[model samples]
Target: MAIRDVRAYIEEHGLVETADEESEKSIWRKSGFEGVRSFGEMEQILSRFIREHRDARRLNRAQVGIMVGLHETIFARYERAFSKLHVTRLIHLCEILDCSPIEVVHAAAPHLFGDNRKEADDKMKLILCILDMPALTAASLLAMIEGLVGERERSGD
Candidate 1:
């Protein structure tokens, strides 16, 4: 199904309130599951994506909830089940993981997977742009990111 059809399904399922145009629009625009084969497929896609991001920011239950727009309890309750994750939340989580939505879906589907996440993450973190703190000296290099007096500001932030 295309985005329009996905939106229609959500509307039919009463998942989107008529008053919340933004939520409705968000589902269509950002949902990674659009045209995906099944909820099982959605689950596989997000699980691997989360695994890839498990080290960064160390997403706690609450953080995962925020990323997926589900309640903390909901996230905790469903953390193990791939079928419960929403497509919209999956896409948003990919953004947080600094990966594309396509990557998440591909990662989930073993049959279609091409990239090795561990390798990619290692390489991605090596990129200068990902180094929040550029340590110019041995002393600075010893400093952990949280130890930096000035939280290195992101370029656009």
Candidate 2:
């Protein structure tokens, strides 16, 4: 099962939220997902990250350009809060979580994009693999997360 499925079961069943990060870590391992919500929760988490992180605030493309050393308008295209991000920018974003592209997709949408649950179990598995990536330095990763979520939202599949 995919981690997405387990997460749904958790939410639908009202599984008591646990304080132990370790216990939280155990969710994907135990549930074995089957499918994910039609309206993905991945974006919600990404939005949370941007809101939680001071540096990740919404900036016009120009501000992001200043931050990432790119053409200001290049970043602006995504300012509407509904555009897919460029991959290069995504790499910059991962550096913040000390995370990887793989980690971001897994955490945010494992069932939709994970390497087949046979290979990927949970978001944590991916996070653990990239745990040593690097602490937040650039706002790129947040943007990438936003982009993916935005893309999913647009499709409305």
How does each model score on TM-score?
Answer: 0.38, 0.34
For candidate 2, the 10 contiguous residues with the lowest summed lDDT are 23-32
Estimate, for each residue in 79-133, the C-alpha lDDT of model 1 and write its tens digit: 4663465677667766766766555545554333324445554444444344454
Q: What overall lDDT goes with each candidate model?
A: 0.53, 0.51
TM-score of 1: 0.38
lDDT of 2 at 132: 54
lDDT of 2: 0.51
Candidate 2 matches the true fold with a TM-score of: 0.34
User: Which runs in model 2 stand beyond 4 Å of their true positions?
Assistant: 1-64, 70-80, 96-98, 112-130, 133-157
